[model samples]
Target: MDKAGSEKSIIALEGWLQTPAGVYMRAWEQSCLDNLTADIFGYNAVQIGMPEIDALAASRMPYKLLADRKPRAAREQQRAVNLTLDYTELPFASQSIDLVVLPHVLEFSTDPHQVLREVERVLIPEGQVIICGFNPASLWGARHVLRRVGGTSFLPRTEELISMPRMKDWLKLLNMGATQSRFGCYAPACRTEKWLHRYAFMDNAGSRWWPYLGGVYVVQAIKRVKGMRLIGPAWSRKTAAAPSAVPATNKRREQQDG
Candidate 1:
């Protein structure tokens, strides 16, 4: 998708996020982000998209930046944008950012692989990235698949729904290791708030019984870069020489002289 097309997709997704099901999904996503980001200690952090939820709100990073392809995005997300750039090409220097948050950006991006590559490029070694997205293996996903057949779809039609396994593969290809993964929003797809609240108990059960089946998943990954081991230094380390051992008779004579 082009810039304008991507922006329109985001707008549609945002609109859907206001619905009852979307509200529930957002609450779950927000709670998960808060818990996950609260303890991530770092100097710099950036939330690439989904300014709607303030992905880094719980982060204590001194330098926090909100980036999006769109201009300003109305600051409606309550957070101001520090950088407006394409996900495929981040303005920051390579390995400069400590943390990058992507809230449902991959499924919406034109080239999710390039977006992830950019994220990996900007992340320092051992830097972390948090991703939020839909799972194609859940009830919500099934509903989307069913709706896709008809003219009306539950989620944004522009989305190219990706499974968690596919995402893991993408991150792995970028040399980013998954450190933590979570799934939530187990309730059946319900358009009304009342029905959604009715099935809230399934959240706990789903967590224990069918974790990977959750509608949404969050993956926390760290950029893994292997360091080369220096075998020897240019200047050799000094070594102390040991005195040679003498025969028993010579040892006695030396003791007497002492």
Candidate 2:
């Protein structure tokens, strides 16, 4: 989609995120992110998109920043290091960031693969990346389809939800190893708060039986670098090199004399 169109869609989704059902999804996502990031240690961590969620609130990293397509006045005033840049073209150097959190960014992008490629580029070897997205093969997804068929629009325009297997394939293409994943918010879509609360039982039941069919999912992956070798410090390498070279040189000289 075009820039203006994408912005409008994002705004609509953000608004929905404040509604009763959306609020329910946000709470589960927050709890998942909090637990996932708490133990993640890093020098530089970044959260891409979804500025309203504060995805890194539980992280203990000293440097945490948010990157989004647009800058907000409140974040600017707070000096929160919110960079206004496209997800496909991050300004950071390769292998610099230790952790990256992408909250509902992939499915919304025009090119989700490009977004993930950029994510892999900025992450250090073995760095962690957390991605949260709406699951397409679920009751919530069914609701989205039914609403569309009934000529009622409840979700964001052009909402392209991705399935778990497809997401795993994308991560694999980027040389990222999928470490863990979680699914939650099993309740069905309900317009009224009362009905939404009533369906809370689905959360426990679905988790025990149909866990993969949750409305939303969180995935954690680690960047993997091939053909990498572990080496000692420069000083140690130089020190060890000198003795080996000296012995070889002396042996060659002695053979020549003989």
Candidate 3:
């Protein structure tokens, strides 16, 4: 999608996020992100898109950068951008970033694969990336399908919501192994907050009964570089040939002189 179109779509999605369904998903995502990132210590952290929620709010990283695809006015955004650049082409140096949070960015991205590649490129070895997205194998996903038949769809142009399995595959290809994953927004899609509150019990029930079938998911993955070794002190090993280094003839001569 063109830059303008991408911006427009995200704006629409942001608007949807203010509604009852969006609020339901947003609160769940916020809690997940908070718990996941709170204990992570890093020098640099960046959050991509989803200005509605601060993905790194709980992180104690010295520097936090909020980036979006386009330039947004400060007053207009709840989570304003610190940098405005293309998602597929991040300007940061290779292996420079410590933590990256991507919230609902992949589904709407024009080149989602390249975006992941860019994330892999900027992330330092062992650095972490948290990704949040809509789950296609859920009731929310089914609603999108049903609504499409009526010549209307409430979801942003994310026609193909990426599933957990597919997301795992993408991470594996990037060498970013998923360490932890959580699913949220268990309640069915509802148009009003009253209906949403009525189904609030579903959240706990779904978590225990059908955790993987939630409407949204958050995955935390670490960038793993091949051939990387752990940092530790070098311990010297005493060898069997150590005593042989002292010439036997010299020892014998010394004994005879004595």
Candidate 4:
């Protein structure tokens, strides 16, 4: 889709997320909470999503909220913390935050690059940004196909389902060097049989063999240092020296020519 169309689609999807299917499709988000909590245990972090996540992080470390809308309950639940702000334009000063957790934000963002740039802007030099995304090449993605063909239509059409490689490229563009990446949710997207679902945990074993096949992928990247400029004089300083004032230069040239 074109840029404008893509933006509209993302906004539409964001609104649809409040629905049941949207909620179901996004259930994988909760699975990453454990990882996020572990990573940001004692840092000034920002939870950019539903308000409930703010409360979830309250007991552990200092965290603020940044969502499109004000979550009244979330605000009331964490009354002591008043750091709520807009995601597009954050209130924090440049390079102020130590950690930023992106739980399914890429999937729903109209402008993923802009969001990532904002993440880069708010992060301190060498700060870390943890991102979670669904793998389009996995069994889970295959299952999504069935849902689409079957007319299940749980959530708005996904704007973009990026693979790990693309995400790595984005990190490079934003100057965030990817330090580590791992996959999760190995279970097949569709459980045609009951046993398949029953043995879903077996997918975890497969991860040992084929880590990329996992339904979800997690990447941790550290902001890289900026490039430096070359410093030197524009012109050579010795070029201006006059050739030992040759008064007989013409005569010497005539003699050599003769």
Best by TM-score: 3
* Candidate achieving higher lDDT, 2 or 3: 3
Clashing pairs in 3: none
User: Each candidate: what lDDT?
Assistant: 0.87, 0.86, 0.88, 0.65
lDDT of 2 by residue, 72-189 (tens): 6664313343688898898999999999999888867887899999999999999999999888888877776777677566556655788888898999999999999999989886
Q: Sort every candidate by TM-score, greatest first.
A: 3, 2, 1, 4
Using lDDT as the measure, name the better of candidate 1 and candidate 4: 1
C-alpha-based local distance difference test score of model 4: 0.65
Candidate 2 positional error at 202, Å: 1.3
**TM-score to true structure, per model:** 0.86, 0.86, 0.90, 0.64
For residues 19-73, could you state the per-residue lDDT of candidate 4 as single tens digits?
4433433444455555555655445777665443332342265654455434344
Which stretches of model 1 miss by more than 4 angstroms? 1-4, 73-77, 228-258
Could you tell me which residue pairs clash in candidate 4? 139-189
Q: Judged by TM-score relative to the true structure, which candidate is superior, 2 or 3?
A: 3
* Number of the candidate with higher TM-score, 1 or 4: 1
Instruction: Note the residue pairs that clash in candidate 2.
Output: none
**How many residue pairs clash in each candidate at the backbone level?**
0, 0, 0, 1
lDDT of 2 at 58: 97
Candidate 3: tens digits of C-alpha lDDT, residues 183-212: 988888788999999999999999999988
